[model samples]
Target chain A: MTTPAGTWNWLTDPAHWAGEDGIAHRLLEHVVLTAVCLAVACLIALPVALVLGHLGRGGALAVNISNVGRAVPTFAVLVLLLLTPVGRWGEGPTVVALVLFALPPLLTNAYVGVREVDRDTVRAARGTGMSGRQVLLQVELPLALPMILTGVRTAAVQLVATATIAALAGGGGLGRIITAGFNLASTPQVVAGAVLVAALALLVEGVFAAAERLGPPWTRGGAR
Target chain B: MPPDDCLARNEWICGAYLSTRRRILLDATLQHVRITVLAVLIGLLLAVPLALLARRLRPAAGPVLAGTTILYTIPSLAMFSLLLPLYGLSESLVVAGLALYSLTLLVRNILTGLRGVPEETRQAALGLGYGPLRLLLTVELPLALPAAMAGLRVATVSAVSLVTLGAVVGHGGLGNLIYAGMNTYFKAQVLTASVLCVVIAVAADLILLAVQRLITPWTRTERA
Candidate 1:
């Protein structure tokens, strides 16, 4: 039977599989970019959010600031950076924009997670002579694990999706394929690229969902 | 300075760009706003009924929720490509993709809000001879406004941001400028366009927040 459209043909072509602009190379670039951004964003966001939650202070300030940051679209940030000196440095602007894009969900979820830990449980931990660090690590962090994972999941999916926009900055990603398709006026290639991106995003989401479920048994809601 | 001196020199923050390109920017922004607002409104219209359906029929809750979640997982680039065939590179393609993206947030939040209505409150409303529709409209919906508003704010901000991606199709309001600017490495256009997208997203979020607060004054007292 004939293929429904050129989409399948474009995707299955052997020549598209080789060279620097190949699907594999672009996919790798997308993943590496996403991973690096997620790592940096997590490093920056998790500690501050966790610390603030541990100290039981500054929820309003943190959440409000992050919300404003979140409001700024990632696309604008990516494009703005592309015009800067740094944007010329290859992946710098993309990484920065993506990191910024990923920060809000990570920050908000981790903060809310740690803060939402039962107050009595925390007090008891302190009463039992646990240091503030101990309470944060042993009591709050464990309970907040699922929530933090949730933030990670959100950030991961968004990063995978938005990393495609990085192609507009001349950064590598599956999005490059779509943009290239547009340049060539090839609907099939564009559709094919979109399918790959959507698949990757969904895959990342599923991985994170599994990760969330893999949290301590308490995440499943049994333990007190 | 010549009217287009900044464009010639490629300055990042050119007053000349703004003055010379005001009409273009205004049109882009208006398009951006029109698409974003339309997407969110359509999203809410669809999401409310879906949320109500999920709430009304326990068996449907899983599928309805899962479907939106899957939709949300698709990357914006891919979402547009997948939708290209249906909408044929039209503005409606972008609007439809954004609306679909907003569905997960809207349906989930609205459902959560509706579910969160106190059982006693619902029961009391029922006992008062309030018809089902009246109960939903007057009591349940008002009570659900806070959660629903939270989703709306997020959906609106994201829509404002994502509409820029529509530039891939020559329909991405401010995104078109950003896209064109990047191709030419035109500093002023890219920076100006990007900043405008952020400003729009931030302003839209603030407006939604104000609307939420205005409509849900009870939440303020409850907090106090």
Candidate 2:
């Protein structure tokens, strides 16, 4: 029975904006969940990708290993974890699933980023008496920063989208808005919730795209 | 073992769950395959023209690419909710949302593939009496297949994963099982459905990989 006008009305209502289930609260939850997942994923994935990329060997193996789980949808992982003992701890399953989901792209890009550094550049650094560690840090890291950032950009945007599943696990996020609306059979409310999440995701994407494009000189402007 | 034993024990891996739910599982998998295939195919269809337009017109490239990437950043739930008004709570909503999701991967890779076709190759084709349309069909498109297929493979796999989110809309293929089972803590049901989802995704990816190689024999020959 709800119409587009109803959706507008629902969005404009201050009643839905000020309580525990308000947009502000849900937005906070979504941001916190996504940030936590991305931070944890980066800590785990970056070092492995960077190191493997520097060594110039086994980068593919490491990336592929992480990717084996890629075929399994993140939501499925979240549900499986919830069905386990891990679900006993609130928010635990969501975190674990999101972290795992974010790993593959982060690992792939970080590894490829560092590996893409010109071979001759590394060789020149080595011939100049730079240690392997120094070359990795001084030569490879800087050039790879843009590509690594590309990975982060990809992971962050995806995490924002995926983190909405946290709401399904009874954790807080914008997804609760939509699910709650569904329970109430309010299509307008549901559309409003969708709008908020989509706006947030696009905003995140825009910010990261800007960061990647306007980053350091080594940042390739396009075609990553 | 008794059919209900696994259910009674709340096991994570249960043969009984599969045996008992075989028909249900098959239906869910079929729905999942249907949704994923439809979404990816629709995505490919949309991507070709967009990629072509982008390559053909330099000014259009930025917007077309940006638009698709922005679409991608919209979280799956949000995307579905946004489309709720248009398609209601049905498989079409899920398919439309997923098709949008696939566009970023599809468009980017196809564009890359198209651009990857060497200028020299185009010149050769033109020199040999190939007009624009003919040149595109025989020379440009064939060269772009490897990249286009790569994109398709990625889009297809991710679609399988994302389709699980459709459970929220009441049509998430295997996601419906996982979603329902999670509510009552049906461990056997949840695990069985998830494993099937993984299997489908992996199997689809392998098939696509084979297709990519088969179509782009020249790529292999060059590598060899």
Q: Looking at every candidate separately, what fraction of the true A–B Cα contacts under 8 Å does it contain? A: 0.75, 0.80
- Evaluate candidate 1 and give its CAPRI docking class based on DockQ: medium
Which lDDT tens digits does candidate 1 get at residues A1-224? 22236888888898897889999898898889899999999999999999998988988977886777766777778877777787777778888989988888888888889988999999999999999899999999998987887788888988898899887667788999999987887778888899899899999977866765786677643211
Q: Give the Cα lDDT of each candidate.
A: 0.86, 0.87
Error of 2 at B80 (Å): 1.1
Tell me candidate 1's fraction of native contacts, as a decimal between 0 and 1. Answer: 0.75
- What is the i-RMS of every prediction? 1.7, 1.2
Clashing pairs in 1: B166-B172, B167-B172
List model 2 lDDT by residue over A76-121, tens digit each.
Answer: 8998898778989999999999999888888888888888788999
- How do the predictions measure up, each by TM-score? 0.92, 0.94
Worst 10 residues of 1 chain A by lDDT: A215-224
Query: Which residue window of length 10 is worst by lDDT in model 1 chain B?
Result: B1-10
Q: Output DockQ, candidate 1.
A: 0.68
Q: Which candidate leads in TM-score? A: 2
Q: Enumerate clash totals for all models, in the order shown.
A: 2, 1
